[model samples]
Target: MEELMFCYQCEQTIGGKGCTKAGNCGKDAEVAALQDLLVYQLKGIGFLGNEILKQGKNIDKEISKFVQDACFSTLTNVNFDPERFVEYLNKSQKIKENLKTLLGNVPANAPECVNYTIPASKDEMLKDAKKAGIMYDQNLDMNIRSLRETLIYGLKGMAAYAHHAHVLGFYDNDVDNFFYKAFASTIDNKLSVDDLFNLIMEFGKVNLKCMELLDKANTQTYGNPVPTPVLITKKKGPFIIVSGHDLKDLHELLIQTEGKGINIYTHGEMLPAHGYPELKRFKHLIGNYGGAWQNQQNEFDNIPGCILMTTNCLQKPRDSYKDRIFTTSIVGWPDVQHIREIDGKKDFTPIINKALELGGFTEDEPEKTILVGFGHNTVLSLADKILDAVKKGQIRHFFLIGGCDGARPGRNYYTEIAQKAPKDTIILTLACGKYRFNKLDFGSIGEFPRLLDVGQCNDSYSAIKIAQGLADALGCGINDLPLSLILSWYEQKAVCILLTLLSLGIKNIYLGPTLPAFISPDVLQVLIDKFNIKPISTADAELKTILG
Candidate 1:
C-alpha cells in the first residue's frame, strides 16, 4: 500500500513507530494531509509573527488565538474533518499574509513555508498537504529532526492549555509570545541540538505559568474544588453526558438543561466538573457516567442519553451513537453535529432536544460513587495533616500515577502499581488516567483517602503544588522527598506536562507504555542521562524497585 501520512506524536502510534496509512486515532489520509498543511502554515504565521515582534510591535490577541486554536485542532483526535482543516489552511494563509504586510520588509529569501502561496480549494490544499508534512525534510539531521518534532508537539500541548485558560477570560502575554518564539524556532536551520534543548527546557517553566493561569481562571471563576463524591452510576430519565475538558461548555449545558427534565453527567475529563462549587450547584448536573475516553465506544453504545464532546480525546464515533453525539469547540468528526458559538455564546437547545428525544436510562442504575475535587487548594489546606502523618511514620511514600489514558496494551502497569504499592503509601493522581484503578477499594490512612485525585490533567499544577508544599514544609528539594512519579502518556498535553516536569529538574519519572517514537536514540539518552528518567517495566518489578 502507498504511504499517505506519517504521525507518531501519540503513545499508541503503530508499532511505536509512525502511523503511515491512517492515524491510529481514526483520521484518514485526506484529513491527515490537510492537518499537516495547516501546521506547516502555522509555522509560517509564527515565523512572521516573530518578525513583527522583533520590530517592537504588538500582534493582535486574535492572531495569537488563531495560532493557538490552529495548533490545538491539529492535535491527536481533536479534529478529523477534512473541510475544517481546509478552512484552517486558508485562514492561516490569510493571517500569514496580514502579518507579512504588518512586518513591511519581508525578506524575499524567507523559508519556503513563509513565502509559499496557499492553494485555495480543498482538493488543492490536500495535494499541497501531502508534501508539507514533517517527514519532507529527508536531509535534516535525525537528532535535529527529533528535537524539532518534540518542540512542536510540546507547543501544541501548551497551546491547548492556553486555549482553555483563554476561554475562561485569562490571558498571559508571556505564554502567547512564547508560542511565536517557539514555533518560529522549529523552522530555524541554524539552531544546534543544545540550543533546541535549552529552548525546550525554558518551555517547562512557561507551561507551568500557563497551567497556573489556567488554575486561577478555573478557581476564581468556579471557586476552589472541594472534596466531592461523584456518582459512577446512572440516573433514570433524560440526561446528557458531557465529555472532554471544557467546563464552560458543561456549565452552559447545565444552565440550558435545568428544569427541562434532563440530567447532566460528566464523561472522561469532565468528571472533575462535579468538584467545582459553581458548576455542581446545578442539581441537574448529576454525576459522571464513564471511565475514560478509550472506553467511550462501548460505554456510549446504545446508551439512552446524547453525548457532547467539548474538546479532544474524541474517538471516531460508532454508527450506533454517532448521530446522538455532538461536538463543540475544536472537536470534530466527519458527520457529527457541531455546536458553534454565536457571538461568543453557545445555545444548547438542540442538545436539550436530543436528550428529550432519546430519553435516558429506563431504570436507575445501582448507586456507586467516587471522590473528586482534590485540587491544590484542598490538598494544601490539609498539608499540616499530611505532614503530621509523614512525621509519625503513618505514611511511607507518595506515588503520582496519572496522565492521558489510551486503549493501547500495557497501560495496566498503572493499575498494578497503584494496587501493589505499600499499604502505608499515599497515592496522588490526576487526569483521566486515574480510571485504571480509581474504582478499587484503597481505604484511607486516617483522615486522607489512600487515593487523592487532583482534579483534571490541567490541574497537574495542584500535584506540583502539593509536592512543592510538602518539600517546603519538610525543608528539602522536591526530589529529596519520598515521592515517585509513574506517568502514562497518550497525547500532546502529556508531552507539555512532561517538559514542564523535566524543566523543573524533576527526575526518576517512570514513563510508559512506550517511549515516544519522535525522541531519537541520541536525544533519549540525553534525557535519561540528565534526569534519570526510565522506561516502565512490569508493575511488580517497578513497585519493588520504587519501594526498595
Candidate 2:
C-alpha cells in the first residue's frame, strides 16, 4: 500500500479544509514531515544567526544564501522528489553545522534522523513532531499560534524573494538579520500575540528593503523597461517557452539560442518580457505562448516546443509533455531533467536543441497581442503627463488590484472591482493575480493602457517605484496620492509583498480573497490598528468604503 501523507498548504487540497489522508498536494506524510523538519532546522539556524548578529557579527553571503534556500525548499510545489528532499535536508544540516562553527557555539540539533528504509508510521511522526521546535507548545492559545504562523508564512515568502535576489548576486545584511530574529522569535517561549503583531509589521518593513534591492539589481542590469506588445500565438518554427520568475536563466537561454533558429516565448510571469530594454532587444524573443500558470498542463499538451521552468508554480507534468520539460535553479520534480550550476554563463544549448527537434506549429497561427512594459520607468517617464491629467480631473483614482490567483471561487471580487471602478481610474497589476481580469478591455487613458502589467510578483517592486515617483511628481507622500491598494494574496510571495507595503507605512490597504489562516484575532487586530488593514468585502461595500 502507498502510505498516506497529510498536508493542507493550499486552498484546493482534498477539501476546502485540509488533506487528512494523502496530501491534497500529492505529498506523502513522510515528505511532509521532512519538509516540516527542514523548516524546523531553518528556524534553528535562524536562531544561530540572530545570536551572532546581537554579538555584532555579520553573516556572510554564503550563510545568507543557505538560510534563504531553507525557507524556499518548503514552498508548496518546489521540491517533491524524495531524493532531492533528503539532499535539501542534508545540506541544511551542513549549513547549520557550519554556522555553529562560525559563531563558535553549538545550538540545538534536529530530532533523530528518520529511517527512510522503513518509513515511520503517521502516528509515530505526529508524536515526534510534538517536540519539534519553539512554536510546538500545545498549551499556547490560538492568538499566539496564529501570530507565529503568520510571521513564519511571511518569512517563507520573504525567503523566496531573497533566494531570487541571491541568484542575481544581491544581499542585504539588515534583511538577513531580521529573518533570523523572526525565526528565533517563533521559537522564543516569551512571545505573545502583541509581540508577534509588531513583528508582522516589521516583516513588511524589511520586505520593502529587499524588494528595493531586487529592483535596483534588475533595472541596473537589464535597463529600465519600456512599453512593448507581446503576441499570444505559437510561430511555425522551432521554439522554446520559458516560464517562472528567474530572469538570469532566461537571459542565458536568450544568449545560447542567439542564432540557433529556436524562437523563445515567455509564459506565466515571464510574459512581461516585453518591457525590459535588454531582454526585449532580442529579436528572436518572439512572444507569449499561453495564459496563467494554472492552465499550463492543457497548454503544454501536444505543444511542439521545449519549456524551461526556472522557479515555482509548476504543476504535475502530463505524459505527453513530460520529456520536454526542463527545470533549472531550485525547481525540481522526481523524474524530470534538472540543470544545475552554469558552466560559464549557463549554456542553454540542451534546451535549444530540444526545441529544434520538436519543431513547432505546422502553420503560422493567428496570434492575439496585448500591450505590456508598464514598469516604474515607463510609468515615471509619463508621470508629468499623468499628474497633469489627474489635476485636470481627467484621471481620478488609481487601483492597485493585483496579487496571486488560485482556484478559489471568491476571486471574482477582483473582476468586479476592476469593472465597477471609476472610469478615470487605472488598474495596475502583476503576478498571476491579474489573470482574473487581464483580458478585459479597459481602454486606454491618454497614451497608456487602462490595465497595466508591471511584471511578476517580485515586480511589485515596479508598482512601488511608480507609486513613490508619482507621489514625488505631485509633491506628496504615497499615502496622500489618489491611490487605493486592493490586494489579493494566496501564497508566500504575496505575504512578503504585503509585508513590504506595511513596512512603508502605506496604510488603508484592503487585502483578501480570504485572509491568511495563520493569523489569530489578536494578531489581526494589531495589524488593523497599526496599518488600518481590513479584509476585502464585496465590490459594493469596499468601493463605498474607499471612494465614499
How do the residues 368-389 of candidate 1 rate in per-residue lDDT, one tens digit apiece? 9998889888898998999999
lDDT of 2: 0.77
Clashing pairs in 2: 5-29, 204-499, 205-503
- For all candidates, the clash counts are 0, 3
Clash list (residue pairs), candidate 1:
none
Which is the leading candidate under lDDT?
A: 1
**TM-score of every candidate:** 0.99, 0.91
Give the least accurate 10-residue stretch of model 1, judged by summed lDDT.
125-134
Off by over 4 Å in 1: none
lDDT scores in order: 0.90, 0.77
Q: lDDT, candidate 2, residue 226?
A: 77
